[model samples]
Target: MDTPALIADDLVVLRGGRKTVDGASLTVAPGEIYALLGGNGAGKSTTLFAILGLIKRSSGVIQVAGHDPEVAPDAVRAAAAYLPENVALYDHLSALENIRYFLGLAGQTRTGAELDQAFDAVKLAPAARTRRVSGFSKGMRQKTAIALALLRQTPVLLLDEPTSGLDPAAARDFHDLLIDLRKRRVATLMVTHDLFGAADTADRIGVLQGGRIAQEWTAAAQGPRFDIQALHQSYAGPDAA
Candidate 1:
């Protein structure tokens, strides 16, 4: 065992007087990329929120980097970087300025050149480096978010809908970035609707249905062939075998 980098044991969450997460348990070791799948309202996002301490979990223990978020929120957040579906940034600020601001908030200051270098890592265009974010596309914004996380150099990452709404080329680049992150030993947990992405990047894919893990699969070693359509069918059908 590599000593789990993230753990959620019997975690539960309630919303609108209903059970959303019912005794969910999960663990992720270092250097592993886990793809979390589920139907609508299956608690996938809830689980991530619980682990991040974004929402108050109703019950169970959640740990990241050996620290409970409730007991040590700063430490837990420091050990992990999260990228939501939409990154909140000042639309008028340049990419470099955005990086400096977040890094400074975390007490890590960056020079202009250093900030540009970080954006370059995610293949941001030089012109965009100094341009306002209001003009940047969704892909550019997502890249900026990733670059910020990369700057933090956290051990764990939780991504929700990372590739959603991106074009084919942009999505492919995003996938490549994630693969590179895995090589750098970042423990990853992604909740995505893109099954192809899961097959391409994840060492393991876990399906969460009705609040419980329904199945687990390994990627094919020789090729990029994953039957996501079939898996989706199986996932949607109540009679899946």
Candidate 2:
């Protein structure tokens, strides 16, 4: 079997002397899209941050591409590309310029043609390439972020509410891009509240409650086999189910 791209075992986090994430565990294999689903304050974003070493874990283990994020942050960062809910970009910089600058920070430099190709792969308009991101819509900004991820060619991708503000068309485009990434054996972990979108795009869905994964479901080999009603109940609470 192939090594998992991301793994968290009995992970724990504390804030204000209270457990925010308790005994949370998950594994995302290469080429698989795993959705971490939950309501607000369910510790979904916190879990992502912990995996990225942005927040220190109180206990448990985390491995990204076989490297511990805390002990080997540089290695983990090199192997993982992260896209937060609101991707920050320079307003004055053009889409292409933003990508170039960010890639440079990662010690990567690419030619204009290569950058343009990445933009194209994300379905960003050729005209938008030179346009300042200040005038771009949320979807356009997300495409630019996706383009950066493609350029980096990281083995693992982490996304936080990636489709929150996107329209149906834009969201669809993003899902297609994820599928393409999977073909390249890139693992993906997405935190989202969109049950239907998770059903449509994720290879597996893990419901988080009280900072723990309370339930999990796998997509059928033929396609997604999610029971939306049950998922809704699960989100409501254990009693609701």
Candidate 3:
């Protein structure tokens, strides 16, 4: 088997003495799109945060792009880009400005032409390129964030609730964008509540319930039998219940 691009072993998190993520363990290989699915309060966000070094893992080992965040944050972060459900962009900054700014933070220095191409690749509207994000819609903001990620050219992507509050049309577009990223061989970890999105986009799915993955759904044939319903029910294993 190919070596995993990301790995988590005995991932644990605590908030007010509650074990939110209890002993979650998994490995994600290169070019694989993995979805972390669960209902609210299931610790999906917590897991992503821990992996990104946003919230320290109380007692777990997580390797992102062959680097340990606890021991080497800069190296791990350099290989990954994070897009949370609610991206925090400067409302006063134009999309291009936002992309340019964050790219700099990632130690990236792209020329204007390169930056523009990144925006176009993510399908951000050229018409909205110069407009401040203050008035842009959620979808527009997300596209800007994606542009930043693309420009950074990270190997691993970590997203939390990526499709929340998006209209069907916008959400569909987002799904397509993710598919395109996979074609480019970027390993993706999507924390999503949208089961339909999970069924369509992810190569594999894991349900995070009770602090452990109840079961794993490996890649199925590409026909209509991706088994969306089976995945839904599989989340509720005897242990999960």
Q: How high is the CA lDDT of each candidate model?
A: 0.85, 0.92, 0.86
lDDT, residue 103, candidate 3: 74
TM-score of 1: 0.92
Worst 10-residue stretch by lDDT in candidate 2? Answer: 232-241
lDDT of 1 at 147: 89
Runs in model 2 with CA error above 4 Å?
A: 237-241
lDDT of 1 by residue, 92-194 (tens): 8987788878988998865667667667778898888778999989999999999899888899999998998999988898988888888888889999888
- The numbered model that scores best in TM-score is 2
RMSD of each: 2.2, 1.6, 2.4
Q: In model 3, which runs have C-alpha deviations exceeding 4 angstroms?
A: 236-241
> What CA RMSD would candidate 2 show?
1.6
Per-residue lDDT tens digits of candidate 3, residues 3-23?
Answer: 888999999999879999999
Give the C-alpha miss distance for residue 61 in model 2, angstroms.
Answer: 0.4
Question: Model 3 residue 224 lDDT?
Answer: 64
Worst 10 residues of 1 by lDDT: 232-241
